[model samples]
Target: MYAVIKTGGKQYRVIAGQKLKIEQIAADIGQQITLNEVLAVGSGEGLVVGTPLVSGASVVAKVVSQGRHDKVRIFKMRRRKHYQKRQGHRQNYTEIQVETVNA
Candidate 1:
């Protein structure tokens, strides 16, 4: 089975034993985290979507690692002004292993 869950202001599709990177979370490696905002659940039969979220449904996962994403370059320039600005940013992220989805 698979589940749609919300965390760190984002939604992710996860299945048992799956690993995924998401926006940063305040947890250490190997820590257990339960995704409470389960949006939907799916099986070989079909899928069940919720109105906002499914009640009494959740997904459990373990923190695998924490790190930053590759740097993104931002450049800006003005025509004929001989002015330019350049910047780079790396977003933080967390890697989690989906343990199970309970619906």
Candidate 2:
């Protein structure tokens, strides 16, 4: 089965054995975490969507790693003003593997 869950102010569609990187969470490597904010659960053509969150529905995941994404460079310049600015940023993320979707 697959599930739609919310975390870190984002929503993700996930399935068992799938690995994805999400906003950094306070979890250790190899730790199992249950995501209780399940929005929907589905298999084949049968789908159950919750009003806000599915009661008792959850997604189980194992933390694989924590890391940062590639740096994003930002540059701004004003023509005829001789003004320029440059900046870069990297976003932290946590990698997790979906283990199960319980509904």
Candidate 3:
């Protein structure tokens, strides 16, 4: 089975036993996290979509680690104006292992 969940202003399709790197959440390593914003669930028979989210359904996960992603360089320049800017950023993320999808 698989599930579509929403978190951190993003949506992700995940299945059990899968390790996912998502936006950082307030949890420690090995913590059990329940994702209640289940947009849809699949059991090999099409899919069950929810209006916003499925009622009484949830996806369980275990926090594996917390870290940051690779740095992304942002460069902006304007020709003949001698205007240029360079920046870099790394977004925080959480590594979670999907344990189950309860529906």
Candidate 4:
């Protein structure tokens, strides 16, 4: 079965044994986390969607790692005004492996 979950202001479709990177969460490697904001659950053509959230549904996952994404560079300049700006950023993320989707 698979589930659609919400975390860190984002939504993701996940299935058991699948690994994905999400916004950094407060957990250590090997720690199990239960995501309760399940929006939908399904297997093949049978799908159940929630009214905002699915009651009593959850997704279990294990934290595998914590890391940052590649840097994104930003630059800005104004002609004749001699103004310029440059910036770069790397977003932090948590890698987790889905263990189960309970609906």
Alpha-carbon TM-score of each model against the true structure: 0.94, 0.97, 0.97, 0.97
Clashing pairs in 4: none
lDDT (C-alpha, whole model) for all candidates: 0.93, 0.97, 0.96, 0.98
Model 2 over residues 17-62: C-alpha lDDT tens digits? 9999999999899999999999999999999999999999999999
Which of the two, 1 or 4, has more TM-score?
4
Runs of candidate 3 with Cα error greater than 4 angstroms are none
**Alpha carbon lDDT of residue 64, candidate 3?**
99
lDDT of 4: 0.98
Ordered by lDDT, highest first, the candidates read 4, 2, 3, 1
The parts of candidate 2 lying over 4 Å away from their true place are none
| Per-model root-mean-square deviation over C-alphas | 1.0, 0.7, 0.8, 0.6
Candidate 4 ranges beyond 4 A from true positions: none
For candidate 3, give the lDDT of residue 65.
99
**What does candidate 1 score on TM?**
0.94
lDDT of 4 by residue, 1-103 (tens): 9999999999999999999999999999999999999999999999999999999999999999999999999999999999999999999999999999999
- Global lDDT for candidate 3? 0.96
